[model samples]
Target: MSWQIWFVYGLVALAVLLFFSGRVRLDLTAALVIIALAVSGILTPAEAVSGFGNPLVMLIAGLFIVSEGLARTGVASAVGVKIAALGGRSERRLILLLMPVVAVLSAVMSSTGVVALFVPVVLTLAREAGLPPARLLMPLAIAALIGGMLTLIGTPPNLVVNRALIDAGRDGFAFFDFTLIGGCILLLAIGFLLTLGMRLLPQRTSAPSDDRHRRLHEFAEHYGIGDQLRSLRIQAESALVGKTVGEAAMRREHGLTVIALQRGRWLSSLNPVLVNTRLQADDVLIVVGRPETIATQTTDLRLSDQGFPHGLQRRYRESFGAAETLVVPGSPLVGKTLAQANLRARQRINVLAMRRADKPLEIDFQDTQLQSGDLLLVAGSWSDLERLTGPRTDMVLLQMPAELADRTWHANQAPWAVLITLLMLFAMATQVTSNLVAVMLAAFFMVVTRCVEMNEAYRSMNWQSLVLIAGMLPLADALAKTGGADQIVNGLSALFAGHGVYVILVGLFLLTSLLSQFISNTATTVLIAPIALNLALGLGYSPQAFMMTVAIAASTAFATPVASPVNILVLAPGQYRFSDFVKVGVPLQMLALAVTVLLVPLVFPLTRT
Candidate 1:
């Protein structure tokens, strides 16, 4: 073998070691591969960086943005909620109902995003049904992985293999080419999970129901402010009609703290009680104080008594929520009083109560000096509360009320998101434009229609995954250029020289599936795809069946927690161990291998056209 081939082999071995160790980020490892290849003069700089401009990378990026649009607009959340309702407290029935819904969504959207959207929903289902989260989360992850096989754009591996075929001077796969085999696998998986897979999962006891996620009333009860809660509406002729919340002096005169303001009729609008929030006629103020003090103050201030209605609680849950934030050591607010810190004016959130030394402070606690390790209960619109989760030096958000997940930011825009997604699908299925064009148009429409904001569209991208794919593409090219791929294919051909093509297909599937468990599936497919193509051509058989098998095998990352991002996502939440995956995942992997080997040849013949 030439020195170039030897060098490529050495670099690939090192890259695989780094991938398995995971000490370096996958994208960084890919970057190192690119740099090594370019510096060794094996590939020119332009050739090394050509993968960045590849249509496959752009298609993946566009799909991410489109998926984010659906998420931000509440389309995915609504689907999850509707489907979860059909389960009706039966663990078996929930698995039957939930897996198909998740699988179908995963076929169009990102599997990781689909899993994230459903995790909380599934947790809620498990809690309501009196089942352990472990019982359901594994099935959810497996369904998502299988869902990726349903469409050409469902996963990166599908695109990688398609690009390889096109580069090999063949036509690429159509949009729904993967659906038939993928649907069959999904059905088999659902059946397995409903029966044996459920028994294979661990039954770790879930956190107590009360401890899972407390409601608004539960939070008020914990803080001892439930009895103090009151609501009052402003009279038209009242003196405070035009005064701001700070100027109203409700706290100083009546010993009542204004928590929020409801401006529209029927409590249609709710906002955090910021200092600049101006009071107006018919505006309702949700306040906390003793009944005697509140009654006397209302009579004097010309405010009409409006008892706290149950509807207001529903509105509060929908538009506003509370969160617990801890003042960490070295925080700038550690030594300042709540009034001096001015969180209301700056963050537009009310500090409803504070806790120190594991006990709730007195109601009149704003003047109290803040200290490290102090926990404050703050109230705000859900959007503002979400912002606190970002990078901050003053305080860290410890927990949010569970109802926060039900709050939707752009519920009104949901129809537009759905329409745009459907239109994109129609375009792709009909071949009105190339797959890349269809996806890019959808991404553009998502932003133009305000389904997702411009900034959010950019933030929604998984840059790490994109960089990893782009960087690794050149490595595949280097392998092909230096005859490294041919060398590997030659050995495989010799091993299977006397065997039937079906045996070789099974071997290829097993090898791809095994490598996928320990590395990025896209990278696995990129390295294996060219070899599969070369092997098929060298054997005088068509490459379509082999290429299709490679793509399907790369997605069978079900046997390990570290295998896929979706698996890692559910690991901690489900309280799972490594053994739990092996107990369930190995059988599923074998099932997929059987299905792919049996089905691919039937769908795409082995004869070269």
Candidate 2:
């Protein structure tokens, strides 16, 4: 082999190491690979950057917006509520119903989004059903992963493989081409999860019920802040009468946190607490501090302590709400102090308190640097709280007060969102337009119809995934350009020289599935697709069977918590250890392999037509 092929292989090895190390971001690693390829003169600048303009990237972005439309307009939440009602406290029935529902949803939307939508619902169901969350969450994650195999656009790996076919001057896969095989695998997984998989899961203690939907007073008591929450009226002679919250320095000087303000006679109308909010002579301040400190401040500041009113909880619930949010890994907010995040200004919400690993932080936590898995108690208007439920990188909504269940922000547009999604599917399935055109139109309609706002459409795009895909495409191009792909395919062929094609298929599936257990499956698919295609052509067989095998193998990221983002999303909530995934996931991975080896040749035909 030439030095260029050796150099490309070295870069791939380093890239895989970086992915496994978890020290550098996946997208950054891809970007560095792109730079190395371009600067190494293995490929021209145009070839290196060609991936940015790939239709697959645009289609993925458009799908994200469409999925957000369903979420923002309450379509997905409605499905979750219906599932909860149908399951009704039976562990067996819940697993039976939940896995299929999640799988169906994952067929259309991103699997990660589908899991995020269902996590809170599944947690609530577990609590109500008297079952450990461990019993249900693993099924949910597995179903989601299998569901991606259900449609051509179901996962990025499918698209990567399809793009390889199209770029090779062959007809690309149709919308439902993957459905037959994917459907079979999903059924097999559902059965495994319902029986043996259920036994494999640990019956750990359930996640805390306090994280479920609760009333205001319940939330206060759970956080151990009930005694700290007090109401005081500002007297005319009070030094804080005309001062802003920032100017009064209540937290700095008095060690009190003003959480809400009531200005008018009707106590129900609570104004959002903000730094620029001014205090009036008769304003009632709902504050959080030690009881003794509050009493002392009442006298020193010339204010009257009007112990919390009988209807205070009701009034607070009507005007403001509280929720528990988990700071997810890789959040930009990680390592920033609460004061630096400025949630009150940016998100229109205030951080009331924080809990890390089930232990509450100190009172002076404003300057505390945040970390992943920190559960925060935040208070804000119902509208702002509703925004937290949307897709965000900084935090995941663990639970909201029950009052939000009846609150409808975009419920009216749900039918339109569903209609638009169905129409987009119809267009793609019927071949009326290209898949890319159909998806873009659906995204445009989602915005024009007010199902999702313009700004939200932009925010819904997962830029990191998109960049990673674009950046890694050039590496695949360089591999094929530098003859690296041919070398790998030849080695595999020689190793399996006397073995039948079925053995070769099983070998490729295992190799792809193993690589997927650590790195992004999409990147794994990008690097392996060209090699699979060339190997099949070299063996005088059709490429479709090999390409489909590669795609299915890439989605079998079931054997580890770090395998997929969906698995990591459930790791903490389910209280699962590394061995738990191996116990449950390895069997499922073998099941998928068996199904793929038996079905791929039948579905796509290994023999040249």
Q: Give the top-scoring candidate (TM-score).
A: 1
Per-model TM-score on C-alpha atoms: 0.61, 0.54
Give the alpha carbon lDDT tens digit for every residue of 1-609 in model 1. 999999988997887677656477767887998899899999999998887998767876787788777767666655544555677678899899888888998887667656755775676567546678899999999999999999998888999999999999987899899999999999999988888887898898555554667766677777767687778899998888999888987776668778888887532366678787889999888887778888898988888888886546545665678888999999999889988998878998878788889888865887788999998888888988889999899999988886774565665677888898787777764567876887889899989989889998898777776776678677777877998866775676578657889899988988888767755788779888988888888889988899999999999999766577677667656867656777798999888988998899999988865
RMSD of 2: 13.6
State candidate 2's TM-score. 0.54
Which residue ranges in model 2 land beyond 4 Å of their true spot?
88-95, 102-184, 191-217, 220-408, 500-502, 511-587, 596-609
Model 1: CA > 4 A from native: 74-76, 83-96, 105-145, 148-184, 191-221, 225-318, 323-378, 382-415, 449-454, 500-502, 511-587, 596-609
Q: RMSD in angstroms, all models?
A: 8.4, 13.6
Q: Give one digit per residue, the lDDT tens place, for model 2 in 74-136.
A: 565555456657776788889899888888878876676567557656765674565788888
